[model samples]
Target: MAKITFHGAAGTVTGSKYLIEAGQAKVLVDCGLFQGMKQLRLLNWKQLPFAASSVDAVVLTHAHIDHIGFLPRFVRDGFRRKVVCTPATKELAKLLLLDSAKNQKRDAAYLNRKHLTKHSPALPLYDVKDARRALHRLKAVARGEWHELSDPIWVRFHDAGHLLGSNMIEMEIRDRDPPLRLLFSGDVGRYDAPLYFDPSPPPPCDYLICESTYGDRDHPDEDVLEILAEKVNQAYARGGVMLFAAFAVGRSQQLIYLLQVLMHEGRIPKIPIFLDSPMAVDATRIFRTFSKDHDLSEGELAPPNSVLDGPNVELVREHNRSKQLNNVKGPAVIISSSGMMTGGRILFHLKRRLPDPKNTILLGGYMAAGTRGRDLQRGRPTIRIHGWDVPVRAAIDSVSGLSGHAGRSELLRWLKDLPKPKKTFITHGEPDSAESFAAALRDQYQFETVIPQLGESFELGE
Candidate 1:
C-alpha cells in the first residue's frame, strides 16, 4: 500500500518536508530548513527519522529557503538522486542555498568568537562546498511536464505564482487500484499579485495537502500600491535612508517592481534605491531570465527593463560597496536581505540606521516567530544584533497586502473551485492557524479534514 508522511512543517510554518512511499520507491518533497522558535531551529541538527540516502528522489515545489534550505545537509548525508524542479527553481535555489551556506559559516564564526556557548566552538550545519554539491544534483524540468520519479509514481508542476517558478505539485501513485491522486500546495501565492500571474486552478485530486499560512486573518482593506507609495513619501520626507528588511528572492523583487510602478505614476519622488544584498542581486538577474514565466505582456520586460532598471536603481553585490551605503547621504531607499533580520547585509544596515529617528524601517512580508522581523512588527523597544541592543528610535512601518502567501478567503476560493477532496491535510502554518483553517474547511466542505502532526503517516492506498 502507498503511504505518505509529514516529517516537517506539520504544525509549523517552516521546515517543509513530506515523504511519499509507493511501489517500492521513496520520494521526498520540499527538503527545507527549520526557522524561527529555538526548538524548531535546533531540529536542523537532529538526525532525520529516515536515512537521507535511502530516498529515491526529491521534487521541490519552489526555491524559498524554508522550502529548499536543507538540500545541502541532505546531499551531505548521501542523497544522490536528481533534485527535480522547474528550470527557474533550479537557478534560484542555487543562489539561495549558496547564500544560506555563507550565512551559516559567518554565524558560526561570530558565535565562536564570542564564546557564547558552554559547549565546543560552534559549527555551521552545512558549508558552501556542501551547497555546491547539492546544486550539482538539481535536475531542471519544464513546468506542465509529468516526470517519472519511480516506476509507478509521476509528478507534475503547475505555476503557484508565489514566485517566478513556484509550483503547486500533483502526484499520481499508480500502485493504487484507481491510481490514487495526491496534491501538494506549495505555499500558494496571493491572487493577482503584481509581477506574478495568478495561481493556476487546482486540479482534481483524491487528497490534498495545503498551506495555511494566513488562515484566520484577512489583509486590511486598502490599496497596497497606494500604501507603499505613501510609505516611500514618508521616508523621503525624513531625508534619511529607508531600510527594508526583505527576503532576497520574492519580496525584494516585489518591492523593486512596486517602487518602479510608483515612480512611473509620479506618486513618489525620484530617489536612488539600492539593492544591497548579493543574493537579491543574483535573484534579480534570475527573475529577469524567467520573464516568460511571469505575467508580463510582450515587450513589457524588453531591454532597458522599466521595472527593475528604473531611473535610479543600484545593485550592490560587493562588501565594500554595501558598506558605502551607510555613508551615502539619505533621502534614499536601501533594501537588504536575511529577511526577518536573522542575519545578512540587513543587520549592518539596521545597525547603522536604527539609531536615527529620521530613518524608516519598512518590514515587508510575513515575519516568522522568534525572528527580528517579528520583534520589529510587535514594536519592540530595542533590536538585538550581534549581542548588542540597538534602540529602536526609527519609524517602523509595514505594507499590508504585499505578502506572497494567499489570504484566508483566497485559499478558500482556491478550494471552492475544485471538486470535493476525499481528504485534506492542512500544514505549513502554526498549530493555531492550521487548526483554525482546518475547522473553516470543514464548515465549508464535506471533505475529511485534518491538521497532521510531525512524522504523522497516512495510508493512501486502502
Candidate 2:
C-alpha cells in the first residue's frame, strides 16, 4: 500500500517537507529548510531519516524559502533528481537559493569571527557552488499540465496565488485499484490580493494536505492603501525613515507597487524609496519578466514610466551603498528582507533605525514566532542583534492586508468548493493555529482532519 510521511512543517509554520511512497517510486514534495527558533533551525544540520538518493524526484509548490529553500542542501546531500516547479518558480528559486547560500556563508563567517557559534569553526549549510549545482537540476513545466514522475505516478501544478510562482500540487497514484488522488495546498493566498489571482479551486482528492499559517485568525477590515498612507504620512511627519521589513520576493514587490499607487493618487507624499536587498532587486526584475504570472496589467508593469518603477526609487545592490543608507534621512521609505527579521539586509537597517523614536518600522506581513519581528510586535523593550541589545524605541506598525497567507475565513473560502476528502491533514502552523483550523474544518465541512506530528506516517489507502 502507498504511504506518506510528514518530514517537516507538520506542527510548525516553516520547513515544509513531505514524503510519498507508492510501489517502488518515491517522490518528495517541497523540501525546505526550517527557520525560526534555534531548535527548528538545528534540524537543518541533522541528516534526513530517509536516504536522499532513494527519492526519484522532488516537486515544489512555490519559491518561498520555507517551501523551497532546502534544495541546495538536499542537492549537496546527494539528491540527484530533477526539482520540478513552474517556470517562474524555477527562475525565482535560483535567486532565492543563491541568496540563501550567500547568507549562510556570511552568517557563519560572522559567528566564527565573533566566537559566538557552538561549533569550533562555524560552517555554512551549503555554499554557492552547491546552490549553483542545484540550479542546474531545476526543470520548469507549464502550470495545469499533468507530468509523469515514474510509472503510474503523475503530478500537476495549479496556481496557489500565494506568490508570483506559487502552486498547489495534485498527485495521482495510478497503481492502486482506485487511483488515490491527493492535493497539497501550498500556502494558499488571500482572495482578491493585488499582483496575484485568487487561488485555484482544489481538485477532488481522496486526501488533502493543507497549510494553516493564519488558521486561527483573520486580517482586520481596513483598506491597505489607507493604512499605508497613514503610516507613510506619520513617518514622513516625524522626519525619519520608514523602514519596511519584507520578504524579498513577493512582499517587497508588493510594497513598491503600492507605494507608487499611493503616490500617484496623492494620498501620500512621493518620498524617496530604497530597495536595499540584492535578492529583492533581482526578484523585482523577475517580477517584471513574468508579468503574465501575476495579476498586474501590462500598463502597470510596463517600463520607462511603469508603476513598478519611479524616478524617486533606488535599488541598492552594493555593500558600500547599503551602508550609506545609514545616513539616509527621514521622509524616505526603505524596504529590505527577511520579512520575519530572522536574517537579511533588514537586520542592518533595524539596528540603525530601531533606536530612534522618530523612525518607524513597518512589518509587511506575518512574523513567525521566535523571530525579531514577532518580538517587536509583542512590545519587547529591546531586541538582540549582533550580540548586543538594541533598544526598541522606534514606532512599530503593521499593515493589515499585506499578508500573503490566507486567513481563517479565506482558507475556508478556498476550501469551500472542494469535496470533503476522506482525510485532511493540517500542517504548516503552530499547534494552536493548526488545531483551531482542524476543528473548524471538522465542524464546518465534516472533514476527517488530523494534525500530524512531525515524522508521523500514515497509510494512503485501505
Candidate 3:
C-alpha cells in the first residue's frame, strides 16, 4: 500500500505540501509555504515533520508562491533531488523563487531597520543563494507525457488551466492490481475563464485529492467586463489613484487586458496604467513567451496591438519607479502584487493610499484570513501594517468573477463526469470550506470524502 500524508494546505488555503510514499521511493506533490495567520506562517519556520532528505523528488503544480514557495527552504533543509514541473512552470518558478528571496531579504532588512521585528536580527528565512541552489534542481517535463519518478511509480501532467502553466498531477503505482491510480487536482481553474483554457476533464482514478478554495461559494453571475468598467469609471470619477492588489502572474495580466479593452471600446477614457511589481513585469514577459500555448488570442499578447502593451500601459521594473507610484495622482491605475496584501510593494501603496477617501482600493481576487486585504474587504476600521494600524479611509471595492480557483458549482462540474473514487480528500481551503464541500459531495453524489487534517496520513490501496 502507498501512504499519503498532508504536510500543508490540509486545513488552510495556503501552504500546499503532500508526501506520497511507496516502499523505498518517496515523492512529494508540492512544497508550498504557509501564509495568512501567524499560526500558519509560523509553521514555515518549524522543521518539517518528515526528513527532507528522505523524499526522492518534488513534483510541482504551478508557480504560485503559496503552492511552490518553500522550495528554497526545503533545499536548505537537505532535500537534494530533482524538482519536476511543466516547461512553463520551470521558467516561472525560477523568476518567482528569485523574487521571493529578494522580497524576504528586503522585508527582513526593513523590519530590522525599524526595530519592528521581535527577532533581533530579523533575517530572511532563506536568502537568494538558497533560492538559486533550489533552482539548480528543477527539471521540466512536457504536459500529457508520463515520466517516471522512481521504480514502481510514474507521473503525468494535465493542464489545470489555472495559471500560465498550471497542471493537475496523475500518479500511477505499479504495486497494486490494475495499478492503483491517484489524481491530485492542483487548484482547479474556472471554466471558460479568460486567458487560459478550461480545466481538463479528470481521468478515472482510485483516489483523488482536490482543492476546496471556493467550495462553499460560487462566483457572482455577472459579466467581468461590465463590473471592471464600472469600477474603473468610479475610481476615475473620485479623482484619485485606483490601486489594485493583484497576483502578479495571472490577475495583473488579466486586468491590464480588460482595462485596455475598456479604453478601446470607449467605455473608459485612456488613463495611465502602471504595473508596479518588478516580478509582474517579468512574469508578463514570460506570459508573452508562452502566449501561443495559452487561450489568449494573438492581439491579446502580441506587441503593437497587444492588450498588455497599450499606449497608456507602463511596466515599472526599477525600485525607484515603484516608489514613485506612491506620489501618483488621480485618474491613474497602479497594479501591485502580494495579492492578499501579505507582503511586497503593496504594503507601501496601502500605507500611502488607504487613508485617502478619494482613492479606491480594488480587491481583484481572493484574500485569505488574517491578511490586510481581508480586513479591507470586511471594511475594518484600521489595518495593522508594518507595526502601525493604518486607518481605512479609502473606498474599498471588490470585483467578482476574477478568482482563478474553481467555485463550489464549478468544482462539482469538474468532478461530475468522473467515476466515483475510493475516496476524495477535500483540502487547500479553510476548515469550513473543506467541510462544506465534503458534505456537498456526500449529499449530491454520495461520493466518499474526507477532510484531511494537517499531518494526517492514509493508506491508498491494499
Q: Give a tens-digit lDDT track for model 2, residues 1-462.
A: 889999999899999999999999999999899998989999999899999888899999999999888888898889998889998999999899999999999999999999888898999999999999999998999888999887667999999989988999999999976789999999999886778899999999999999999999999877777888898999899999999998988998888888887787778998899999899988988887887766653123334234358888999999999999999987799999899998878899999999999999998677888899999999999999989899999999999688999999999999998998999999999999999999999999999999999999999988
- Over 1-462, each residue of candidate 3 has an lDDT whose tens digit, in order, gives 799999999999999999999878999999898989889989999998889999899999999998889999999999999999998999999889998899999999999999998998988889999999999999999999999997678999999989989999999998766988999999999887767899999999999999999999999887877888899999999999999999988899888887887787788989999999888888888888887656654123334335478678899988898888888887899999889998988999999999999999999677899998888988899999899999999999988778898989999999999999999999999999999999999999889999999999999898
Sort by lDDT, best first.
2, 3, 1
Model 2 pairs in collision: none
- lDDT string, candidate 1, 1-462, tens digits: 888999889889999999999878999999999999889999989999999989999999999999999999999999999889999999999899998999999989888899865558889999999999999999999888889998688999999979889999999988756788999999898876877888899999999999999987767766778889889998899899899988898888888887877776688988899999888888888988887766543123324344578659998888999988889778999999888899998998999999999999998677899999999999999999988999999999998767888888889988897888889999999988888889989898766798999989998857
Model 2 residue 214 distance off true place after TM-score fit, in angstroms = 0.5
- For model 2, the superposed segments whose C-alpha errors exceed 4 Å read 297-307
lDDT of 2 at 33: 90
Worst 10 residues of 1 by lDDT: 296-305
Please, what is the TM-score per model? Answer: 0.97, 0.98, 0.97
Q: How close is candidate 3 to the true structure, as a TM-score?
A: 0.97
After best superposition, candidate 2 residue 373: deviation in angstroms? 0.7
Screening candidate 3 with a backbone cut-off below 3 angstroms (N, C-alpha, C), the clashing residue pairs are none
Superposed by TM-score, candidate 2 places the C-alpha of residue 198 at a distance from the truth, in angstroms, of 0.7
